[model samples]
Target: MKRSAAAFFVSVAVLAAGNGVRADGPDEHAGRAQEYILANDFDEARKELARGKPDDVGIATERARLALYEADCDGALVTLSSPDVAKTEQGAMLADIARGCARVTAANVLEEDHDQGVWIRYQDENDRALTPLIIETVVKAREALTRDLGATWPKPTRIVVVRDLLSLSAMTGLPYESAQTTGTVAVAKWGRVTLLSPRASIHGYSWRDTVAHELTHLAVTRATVDRAPLWLQEGVAKREEVRWREPGPFDDRPSPDAIAARGIELKLDLPLDKLGPSIAMLPSADAALVAFSEVASFVRFFASSTPPGSLERLFAALRDGKEPDSALEIASSGNLKQWDTKWRAYLQSKPKEPLPPLLSLGKEPAPNPKAPSLREVRERMRLAELLLARKHPTEALSELERLQLVGAAGAPQDDPSYRYLRGRVLMALADPGRTKEAEVLFQDPKEVLSSYGPWWALRGVLARSRNDEAIAEPSFAEAVATDPFDVEAACETLDADSPTPPSKDPSPLCQSARAWKVPSGTED
Candidate 1:
């Protein structure tokens, strides 16, 4: 979790004293206002501030806090720049943070949507297609977390989707380098959730799941009144990220226990209590994934073995200022250390999955001795895509064949992009033999899931051709969910010969996709 801005209430109080502005004297209005702000009762906090002298230190700081809490960086800056508040050391620090946030959010706010207590912010017109998915995830998450964790929200959740890691850093105050290191795409901090746009990734990420995961952090903070420790916070968030959705292929593919078991076998797991401030600050993506899996598995174990309301009781204890270990003991009816031991033993019994490759994001390709070979591979892939786009499927096929040979030196055999492009080229050729080859390429559901969009769309098309409705529907849905910006995926229908299905409302993704310009012969 990103740290909250430094507490400026004390400094503001001192500054107020120097100005002979009495705030806590007879009515104690400022004191009560600060208490309300700390409890996240911004409305009540504002009321209390109204009751106090406008220029009172307590009133100004709490008002500023309320503005920051709502992600009103401009409003915060105005409050902090007040003559009395500006002189305080903490106020100056907070002003700097607000300025950074203002710079980052200014562009994203150009486009915005909100409903069902969720606000979505993004910059590009193309990303408008993603608003529905984000809103659906958050709405479901709110209901699920409230039912499971007894979490409540006093304000509408704000979500900002940025185009890059740099904006994510500026908005959240996490260093840009830290985000690149751990492949951190989203963070729930300050007062809102901020995430990287799926379009920014080389291959699209599980952006819907990511939004739910980050929102869970906000729910945890709300439930614990911001007192939950790092381990408890992360563990609970990971455990609940998938709770909003029905059981499906997309649900924690490797499973947390399996990943955690692998991490243990590889000696890559971090101690739950020792995971520093945020997993995003970990040295590498491998370390971050291991840490996430361990905490997620441990929390699942902890939640299951304990009584029905054990997690709620734990949240209550944390809110009441109990230490995390003591809170665990009270909720679980066992010592914290004993609970950890049992969880570890349980994890050992689960089937282990091999550790997946470490992910890299928002960074240039690392220096390689065989740079020319890598460049050739990239060039061939680019030329193949251009060739396929320009109705030169035969040429595209030749380029892909060369790419396959190049892979012999040292490239992944199952590179999803390679398989997806080759399949598309083969389909465009419309030869029975090549079409059969395309079908074979997309037969692996795991491989299809790993690709950005085209593979899933191709899978859907092939399945539809064979009248396999089961695979076609889900594959097309997954394709749209994976990369809605892709015109073909978004516009693809499960049954091309059938009339458009009637609906109370059409899908935003489809609407956006249909309106987008399609390259010639994209679906052939």
Candidate 2:
């Protein structure tokens, strides 16, 4: 989700009325600054402010507004709280918003790290594990966005990973219920990317993609100078989210087109025009998903139909104060309505039977009260793991079989932990048919990719068993990528002939994984 404010021009009008002064009366420089700020031309705004008296309240407020647009919340607060600006009506309103920014960012950030042009902040040292991945994603995403949208990062971009929903709400000013209802784990606001940690989600999320999505919002803000409407902002972001990585396809299984097609069939699709404000504020999780899918599909359609660099021109038009409909006219075939009709016809041509799963906060499904308690389930899983570790394959297999029987009522059939353990047991037994069955269990690479280390490591093992180096290599790489602290996954990615692979360009995680040693109890 990307947070947008009501028009700044409206605020400027309110400030003028409250002070009983004409907006352009006796402060022409301040008035010009306000116009530049609305156009998202901060450099021009700064130049205009320089022409005014430094202590002027209107100049000070516009300066603070520019800082806010750039995600410099602390700077904005300082300007707003200065003696000359603090007492004025305009300053007071800007100050209040700055205070919220302080609460969301500076007040909550407990730790920080930097790499290249990116900085990451979090409350826990444990989240250090995510720093490398965040940096990697941002570095790649920055390049992709620059190439595609001509967006630039004027300063080091910041990524703040908060631990829970309360922190997320405080940071983004999204109501707690709205975020919970729509399963919004992240938002591009305060000129930074603020997100919940992957640990906040029970099954974990495609956080790398989420990071790319939010980063795209920041890019759109920059390219359009805060002029992008919610639909265009979100639509472009969704279209670019997966473009930052290899094998990244916009039309993967249950793709945007597929989801949008299904949403249209169900008549649940929100019109792009009616996706009021933000998808995070949609009525339900289903609405949010449908809306996202719809916009993503439309953006893809719009981008494909237009000539190369049409998106860049679109952003330029928006930044220059063109209305969205007119911007579309500049970017594509003249009539927005006709293009939308063509997009709909294109969407209807997509496969819609397998609708993507409804979007959620990636929370675990609540256990059925009549079924076994979660603790009991964990204990049983642990017992099976211990038996396997002790070389008691028969007992491990038996225990796992019993676990399946008891947990079938409530446990997710695709739970990665269970599959990993069962796959391990099957490997231990050394039965050819069972090994094949284990391969079947681990074959769903998308599921493995979204899961934790165990599933990824297990998939790597299965791939190696079949002498499939192509699958084994990426699987092991993903295992380390998923959980840097997982010794098995880390060590698995190391080459047999040498401690490290021969690649000249090794990732930070890969370097760590190559050097990491397996714990004593773990098998080679």
Candidate 3:
């Protein structure tokens, strides 16, 4: 969280003035506004000042606070027109503070380089918005992975930061059907890159761990490319996350007895080379989770069982384009299939623990006539996003409907979030009967959600249906611009070449699209 030096200094000056000022009066209100500004709660401070009796200090102070928080000087200046605020000592001090904030914010905004994919655009009332932090995290993760895991790291890496969870889901086509939402996802194509949701907390091990996990995917993907196995990919990614001490609470080393007690069980008999393409398209969610877990376990096994140099030798074989079966055979001196079978038999023979109770089940129904809160709606929407990511549209739609019901009850009808999610859920269904419903959401210009990748993708689809290549082109372009690492969106933008009036400056998107030339028959 970045803070301006001027804001910090002003906050200190305000705090030093002390509580000798009485409560329940204008001075007390002024002190509260200053406190709120320091805490980065500009919205509440603005509301408080707006509702109170006329006071120069309250209005000017609030303006300064907004400017400092949003990095929007123009917006702050426009709000400082209160008559009472135009004539006071506090007003003069606020003018200086506002000017300093404006300079700092403008400098920071202007200094950001868009072409390099260094900063992400986002709005927040608090300290530096999540976009910049996500970008920095990705850079740090890539550097760490490249430094620690030399031969395995992918080349020409990039990172993308989406504005919201819904946008993140839209880019990855990850449905919001499940409860747990992913903070980041990696797609290793022309280069290794990760797309992260900026809304997630950027501090602590959770965020760092997500970066490590995604970077591991990049390393494993680079090692295997087309020949990478699912189990190996997942296992390596998980191992890398833990290897970096990122798995945090889950990182304790098991006692030798405990490790023996929890015997290794590789359930699937599939060879490692075959794992790459099949794991993503697994028919059952349970099967997919099991596959991922098994992969993690297998990587852990290799990391523990083999000599230090053995893992590097295995990676070298993978880098040389050897199949996992051959690579494992050469590196470990064992038959890959036989080893897999042994591991599976070992797993099946172990005593299995009972699964935990489902949180979605056995919950009391909501009280009759009570609508869900915005937070509840947001959470359900997040689940819908996960379901979509997991490729479960039917289940995602169920959650979307619940979200719509909540939205209909006094939530802003024009809210972009509701429309965007609805559009995505409908698009995933791909039923012609639902096209109009999806179109309704896509066509809303006021939809705040339209700025996101999925919404733009849906818009492109709608435009394509109407043979309006102009509209479709920009929409696809916007999607790619927002998520530079999205292969699907990049393809759509490249294939779509309609001479549309530029909705946005087309230079960046067009340049990026042109630069992304996939090998003739490569599947990303």
Which candidate comes out best when scored by TM-score? 1
List, residue by residue over 456-500, the lDDT tens digit for candidate 3. Answer: 666776887778898887776555434433333434532234433
Off by over 4 Å in 3: 1-128, 131-148, 151-156, 163-186, 196-207, 224-226, 250-280, 345-355, 359-524
For candidate 2, write residues 46-145 as lDDT tens digits. Answer: 8998999876777777788778766677898888778767777667666766776676565444434443777777754456656767888888998888
Clashing pairs in 1: none
Query: Whole-model Cα lDDT per candidate?
Result: 0.67, 0.65, 0.46
Residues 283-393 of candidate 1: C-alpha lDDT, one tens digit per residue: 866677777778878888888887799999998887777888888888877766788889888887766655323222222334445333655776777788888878899
337, model 1: CA deviation in Å?
A: 3.0
User: How big is the positional error of residue 119 in model 3, measured in Å on the Cα after superposition?
Assistant: 7.1
For candidate 1, the TM-score is: 0.79
Name the 10 consecutive residues with the lowest summed lDDT in model 2: 7-16
Q: What is the lDDT of residue 438 in candidate 1?
A: 84
Of the candidates numbered 1 and 3, which has the greater lDDT value? Answer: 1
Candidate 1, which segments miss by more than 4 Å at Cα?
A: 1-39, 48-58, 87-89, 107-115, 356-383, 398-415, 447-451, 465-469, 493-524
